[model samples]
Target: MTDPTQDFRRHLGQHEYELLEDDWLALLEADVSPALLFETAELAARYAPGEIPKTLLRVLADWLGEKGAHRWRLEALRRLLALGEDGPDLPAR
Candidate 1:
């Protein structure tokens, strides 16, 4: 099977990637929908402009919330990303 993380992994080097590995694996194992993964990828890209900000990554994780509820997670990411595009940077603290 294809590695689901491959898409987002390109944006993160080893050390940074390790921080999110567990959560990514959990989401994968739970069989989150493709749409959710897509939103996650967008969030990953948005979270990291050039250097991956660990703080923003943590925020991304927070936006994603827990597993099991893919729809809302996807929706949350979409709205967040949209707001990010239209307004200021993501919520930092």
Candidate 2:
């Protein structure tokens, strides 16, 4: 079976996987749909969290809150928790 995250992974630009941290984070702020936001968050988690910007991390957290309920929001909330920022409350899984 194919990886469930592959589709999300594909949403990332080549720059993101290249580990050009600045460009990667910038994509998060670009014109992307909520689905892309979920993918970007997942991509960042795959890398060293310490390398990600706190501002962008918080931005993702806030987007998840403002974007309302999508299935990925719950996963995003869990990942954002590792960034030590408060995100919207999600029901216990």
Candidate 3:
């Protein structure tokens, strides 16, 4: 079966994609380091960051502080990979 996320982003076009990307980047805030962000550029490019939760975001920030940039990126991708759809994984409260 094909990945639906691929189809959805493609439909959004490059300009729209960049704009949506900016939204996701904002989610990371100042807690995450620029180096880690650059390292995980592929994750943001390939997957959706908009679906991340606040607790998870904090966890990612802490990972950067403790584990260093590269390790943090590996962990981030691993965490994000757990979210199957990546559209809006926030749980209903």
Top-lDDT structure, candidate number: 2
Per-candidate TM-score against the hidden true structure:
0.34, 0.42, 0.25
Error of 3 at 40 (Å): 18
- Candidates sorted on TM-score, descending: 2, 1, 3
Clashes of each: 0, 0, 0
Candidate 2 clashes between residue pairs 3 or more apart in a chain or in different chains: none
lDDT per residue for candidate 2 within 1-93, as digits (tens), equals: 333244335533343444434444455545466666555565666653454534445566555566675454566656656666463453455
Clashing pairs in 3: none
Evaluated against the true structure, the overall lDDT of model 1 is 0.51
- List where candidate 2 sits over 4 angstroms from the true fold: 1-29, 49-55, 67-74, 82-93
lDDT of 1 by residue, 1-93 (tens): 545565346435443554554546555676766566556655665554543333333344454566545455545445555444333544432
For all predictions, the C-alpha RMSD in Å is 9.9, 7.6, 12.8
CA lDDT, candidate 2, residue 89:
57
Which 10-residue span in candidate 1 carries the lowest summed lDDT? 50-59
Error of 1 at 51 (Å): 8.4
